[model samples]
Target: MSTSDRTWDVIVIGAGGSQAQAMLAASARGGDVSRWLAVDRAWRPETKATTEALGMTTTALDVLTSPQELRELLGSGRLVANLAGPYYRTGTVVLDAAIETGTDYLDICDDADVILPMFERTEAAEKAEVRALIGMGSSPGTTNVLIRAAVDYLGSAEDVDISWTVDVNDMTDAAARHFWHCFNIVDPDGTIHPAPSWEQLERKTVTFPGTVGTQEVIRLAHPEPITAPRFLPVTRCSNFGAITPIESLVVAWSLAFSVDAQRPRPDLAEVTDHAIDVFRTYRETRPATPRIGSGMQIDIHTDGNGLRFSAGADTEMAEATGVPAAAGIVLLLDGQTPNAGVFSPETLVPADFFTALRKVSRGGGGLELHRLVNGEQTERIRIRDLLSQTAATPA
Candidate 1:
């Protein structure tokens, strides 16, 4: 029942350095920082110093190549945060290792193609008595948990619409690659179609909090529609979002069509570089597009009654995504969540989720809630005030 002393309480796989750092900071805020480990494919002096600032040790690792070594370091601990990306490639690899080593797992996986396959591991995870939580990042993360809360608050849940927006200034190579690769659609019944995520993009307007005001969003292939139907009775669920400053989007889309069309997609570094050049070029001439970070709005309806929740304004991609993931981590560490089975974030207790998020994010994650009566905003409320109604309102 014992392994080497190299074990860690939590290991943050730094495929996305920003996300990994955010998680480390959050963990430091939540509890002991000594047991945390920051990992990447190669050692970078700057990264090592960053984690050290947060009081955590760092190491370089290619988990894909060194499974046994990774397993040893993982050491069947509290959990492994798979902050790696283009989840289509790295999701299952880290998850398999986590399950093999009897370590709990979490990730911000938003790829449509991977959810069903991961869920298929439910039996395996439960049998191994290890838990796994997927899609715990911003949109799929906070968005999914809020949907469950709204469903409970509104007394019924159906016909959910989730929309998200991220400032182009915060975009990363992995995020950009996901934008192109996530073109495949997932049905409410868990059937992923052979359609493109951007196929027939429909533009619609949504009002987000603070500087986000109202912005146009279109349907993009995401995991919500694929995974939500497995738990909620919503006849329809879909994901829509964009990396803003539509200026850069044009160049990105143009490049994506060419890059993705190649039988062997070119190194995504090309897309990231092109995106930066276009945004930098336009920033000088294009009218200002506020760098207010990212925002998410989820519309939930049940028996025609609707409710909406949103948070944004000056929050970057890493914090927006990593905070929720950190909250999920705290729950697992403190035994706030069950220790068996593979499941989505929505399955976690909403109040506990928000509570953990509030602690890690240091201010409730900038969340605001509202009640929509007959499709019109009728009342405004706070998360604490709304959660107070849980006991009074019979589920």
Candidate 2:
């Protein structure tokens, strides 16, 4: 089938690496292997081979340089999910292009700065009947969904704390660039502020189920808190995150900041490479926390009561961000998420999202839901089970 006719189901722009590859895998695992299309600025031959082996099509086009080509590609009605990020910049390529073409859009945009601007385009999306789901990655994406779920379960949520710990060893080039941009947050008053991620003053320690065990997390400049209050009826929310192999975040941040403070301002790409090299070397010499890959946990409170939910696996940066992105797209394509215009993951019905999340994960994401008693986990159940219990209860 032709893309303009009945052929392609989804075309992923900026589809060259692990994040896009993971999305393709999950989408294929959920069916429709033959109708996928891929585009990348620096698409490798092996990546092309991988796409072909999966009964897919791929082409290389720099989204930044080739606007017309991207517009032509996305002008069709097929769903377009962009995995390429550092969304503060790439949002122009994916989000703006989709909206301009009046196309439905999905992206794993983790930058809070971009999300705030995306909100301003709500009128355009609604006018064009576009359903733009941004920040579908783990920390911002699934984290937002899980927060929504807990809020729904608890009846109301006020103080919500979401923390994530990802292994530094899994940092990719795009991820590194994103690491830099997340620190520079944009406020509603148009003031761009720097987040104090490396400072020890805000350290909060928490435990996870795996080798990720327990680690200290500081406030991460992420999209959750920025986007949550806009969509959710919550008074307070915060996103805390840290990269592991101990003190790696400090080293990485120092390197990047040192370079940024240089005269004439070096390009962020160079800064990313330098920081990544040093951080990786630091991680290599230090004890490699292999089994302790990454994890995210959420604490939701209503009045004086609280509940906690955590969904984590021994996954890399890409899989953690990509899998749920694919799950969210699947929900949109399956007509489960029918709302048009701009929306967050929480805007989705919690039951539908968790069910698809479990399916796309192929039954491996360790999700736990528990009641918090005196700031301690009291009883644990499958996070998905909360949906079932909610179903059985009469409204």
Candidate 3:
């Protein structure tokens, strides 16, 4: 289909926290107004109120069991930004419908199971001429892009390391809950398996830039395990999760372990209710505090003679995670990405995409990049030029 015939520039499915940020970014791009639509199972009063406050429109949609309905809703939109999560549970159905309708799709999915299945279905997507971009959120999202960019910087990165740390105090209830659910689903076998991102690193301890001091980090099963190796042919690649105050890390570890233990025999209704209660409690208690409750740090290390690169953002966990996904969709809508089937964030986005995202900080959010050359550190605003070749796409 031609670009102009694409009626709605984008159709965002699900009005969750991430979708809100994506929709807002899409609208802010200075295009023809009224070219976007927000669809969700139920009308979120809070989101509805916020959209009305900002002068946008939202429609109700359930893409899971309603393929016919979703096809009608998709109509001639060129892209669909999906923010529904725990991806293992709800992602496939919507993606299937999009593939069937030949609509390019993007989502912030961080589940390995989800990625593996999607990879299995790549042929179908290709056959339908659809592009499915997955894992566009923070750790798996921007972090994927960073590693790709960094690998391109090094002539041929034989070894790569990726690590992430979040200051939990800054996380919103919704963000924290989404994270907790991912942990639960990944470790449901009741085993604290090594992180997929860190499986190959012999040494897992490194100091973050800006004097955060040295801390030990370990690879866990995150979305990166599935996405990174596809783009970068590194002998070793690892991803980790860390938090400060030690206590917060302990609590996160405990909660993850508990979920792993209970998931197999979980009482679905009870678990859902408990999750809701926890989210509500976190929302009420955390944001009022003066401390910078949550922030994220990302580090990427390479093999051979190459500079190590790290980048991060200080903001609420939700924004840290959501903003990048939104930025990715904006790039896709603007035709910045090539028409490819079943791509990941790192595979499709350019280094400048991160630059643009960093420039447009909402709610006091900021991004910082650090480059270490032969143990000498340099700080910079734009790392795209420094690492452009690493993330360059083959023609």
**Candidate 1 residue runs with Cα over 4 Å from true position:** 1-6, 188-199, 261-289, 391-395
Q: Candidate 2, overall lDDT?
A: 0.74
Instruction: Give the alpha carbon lDDT tens digit for every residue of 243-268 in model 1.
Output: 67565555555555555522344575
TM-score of 3: 0.80
**Residue 57's lDDT in candidate 2:** 85
* Each prediction's TM-score versus the true structure: 0.88, 0.90, 0.80
For model 1 the local lDDT of residue 345 reads 72
Pairs of colliding residues, candidate 2: 1-7
Clashes (N, CA, C under 3 Å) per candidate? 1, 1, 13
Off by over 4 Å in 2: 1-7, 185-190, 195-201, 260-273, 280-291, 389-395
What is the C-alpha lDDT profile of model 3 across 5-37, one tens digit per residue?
877777877764544554465445534436777
Candidate 2: give its CA RMSD in angstroms. Answer: 3.3
Lowest-sum lDDT 10-residue window in model 2: 386-395
Q: Pick the candidate with the highest TM-score.
A: 2
Ranking by TM-score: 2, 1, 3
